[model samples]
Target: MSESETTSLEAVDIVRILELLPHRYPFLLVDRIRDIDSDRSCIGIKNVTFNEPQFTGHFPTRPIFPGVLLLEGMAQTAGAICVLASLAKSKKPEQVYFMTIDKAKFRKPVIPGDTVEFHMTKLNQRRNMWWYRGEAKVDGAVVAEAELAAMLVLE
Candidate 1:
């Protein structure tokens, strides 16, 4: 794709994200999605905050965003784009179920006030299932990564 084409792609905001994903507050890790290339790739953003509920129990004096949530963010990012792609085809699924997580690793701790980006790239797709490789980054540095697979269940 040309640079211009990439730049022209519109971002998916929180409102549309809410419509695409079933996760609610505290669980909804992705705040915004951008640089979408159909179901091929996209970047999901999550702004970490000090007042979030997990901070109180995750740690009292020191709070760090859970690594598990980072993985979930990656899955959500991939799943949302999958749903968006299906919607474009006029086939809406009843639910997107997370099927698997593999090769997950945490390289750094994500703390309050950090804006994490989940960069997801499609690895494969078959029938109603899709697989993606995701890297979680903070300040352009990789903090975590994983391979996630999900299935779209139609009604």
Candidate 2:
């Protein structure tokens, strides 16, 4: 691991996450940000449960977490990092809008009872647009990955 990866990160709990993000329960995918390296990278956490509404219809039997939702979770993780960085610079947290998703791949099915860890790194940023690469892991196994782009809407 490089020095940037090894550097210790401060944890941001659910309360702070909620303040930084505009999502709410049932739609909010991220539980907390486990570690943050400002605008460079961060790790996000989500505990999957059978009670989640998606599981009810995603599959009545042999329920599985939706791949699109996994992608959304990763996007949310990236958003949190940007929001934290903005906050640090004394700028109000702006709403991040998805610009694009590319090279998305699902390697394994995520089910209820699995704890997902979303690891995201900044790939590039120009003006208000940011690009990121992210992976979703369960118990150290990669379940999903994607390259995503977003734009900050300052209002």
Q: Per-residue CA lDDT of candidate 1, range 127-154, in tens?
A: 8999999999999999999999989987
Task: Report the C-alpha lDDT of model 2 over 34-66, residue by residue, as the tens digit.
Answer: 767767888899999999999889999899999
Query: Which window of ten consecutive residues has the lowest lDDT sum in model 2?
Result: 1-10
Residue 2, model 2, lDDT: 34
lDDT (C-alpha, whole model) for all candidates: 0.92, 0.85
lDDT of 2: 0.85
lDDT for predicted candidate 1 compared with the true structure: 0.92
Report the number of the highest-TM-score candidate. Answer: 1
- Please tell me which predicted candidate would have the highest lDDT against the true structure: 1
Model 1 misplaced stretches (Cα beyond 4 Å): 1-9
